[model samples]
Target: MEYQYKEVRRELAARADTVIWLDHPFATVMTRLVRRTVRRRAGRVELWNGNQESSLWSVFTDPEHILRWGWKSYGRNRARVRALVGQVVVVRLSGQGQVERWLTGPLAAVGEERAR
Candidate 1:
């Protein structure tokens, strides 16, 4: 599940057997955030509660803009997820390569096991 607060994640993790953490780099995260925001804004897509993305310029003027918020929270989020390593089973995928491998390897194995 997507959660912004550490307390919320911690609570959720307590009941979860495995937590998949996409520990991507800052550059990758920002790039994807910008791309998604631009696509949503350009397409006038409706987000949760009828909220649509604001002007891209809002990245500079709006402190609470999604892009800005993502940039500010990236490091803190990583640290929080890292702290969960020993508390629960966390499959931290750092790069796209690792993610691809995990999907085809370990995750696929689990799927096979469940199908048995």
Candidate 2:
């Protein structure tokens, strides 16, 4: 997770950065299904930190797949985070002046994120 975050940070700072970490290959349900099918049908192999891609059977046969987690978390967390952020003064910052104020003013001292 930290490596992914660091890659994102670096990508933002660099011009035309080819960041593999930022690329979530299984971003869509359809893509994941396709990938799983191809892997199982063709015996296409994949390894993650020395683990094989669950023979592609997990895309359906396994309930604990990442896709399941995504489905469950997306509904719950989006609303939860929205409400949680409402407790803070979420500055939907759009310009440099706001960023400047955030650094030099009380926005930084709020103990949490805040608006101008």
Candidate 3:
């Protein structure tokens, strides 16, 4: 029998001290997704449990495919994260530069502490 709350993730987030969000432009995300998808399909990359991308045709035919889903959900996710600004210690990184800056700055402190 299940003993956990329905919203366990929210419960955990409430108690968490930090949440680092890797935010990127929609174009960048789409570009990455397309490249990754093409590479995986061409190479027949074995994912979890020997699963691989079945067909390139699915990219066009599958309306709920990764490419479509990512494009559609981008704006909704951005808005949701923006709403979390006051409730959590959210680090919203917009691009590679911001990500690198955080990794070398505030994030480095956390990494150094963990190494001790």
Which candidate should be chosen as best, given TM-score against the real structure? 1
For residue 64, what is the lDDT in candidate 2?
A: 65
Model 1, span 1-116: residue lDDT tens: 87567557767877877779998889999999999989999999999899999999988899999998998999888887787788878888999999999889856988989999
TM-score of 2: 0.35
lDDT of 3 by residue, 1-116 (tens): 11123456566666766667778988898999889988998999998899987587886788877788778877876776576678878878889899999889866989999999
lDDT of every predicted structure (CA atoms): 0.87, 0.46, 0.77
Q: For model 1, state the Cα shift of residue 78 in Å.
A: 0.5
Name model 1 segments beyond 4 Å from true: 112-116
TM-score of each: 0.86, 0.35, 0.81
**Rank ordering of all candidates by TM-score, starting from the highest:** 1, 3, 2
The sequence of per-residue lDDT tens digits that candidate 2 reaches over residues 1-116 is 23223346444434322221212223454466556656645764544565554545575777766556555554443343244343433334334455566567774577455544
* Candidate 3 runs further than 4 Å off: 1-9
- Cα RMSD (Å) between model 3 and the true structure? 4.8
| Model 3, C-alpha of 54: deviation from truth (Å) | 3.4
Could you give the candidate ranking by lDDT, starting with the highest? 1, 3, 2
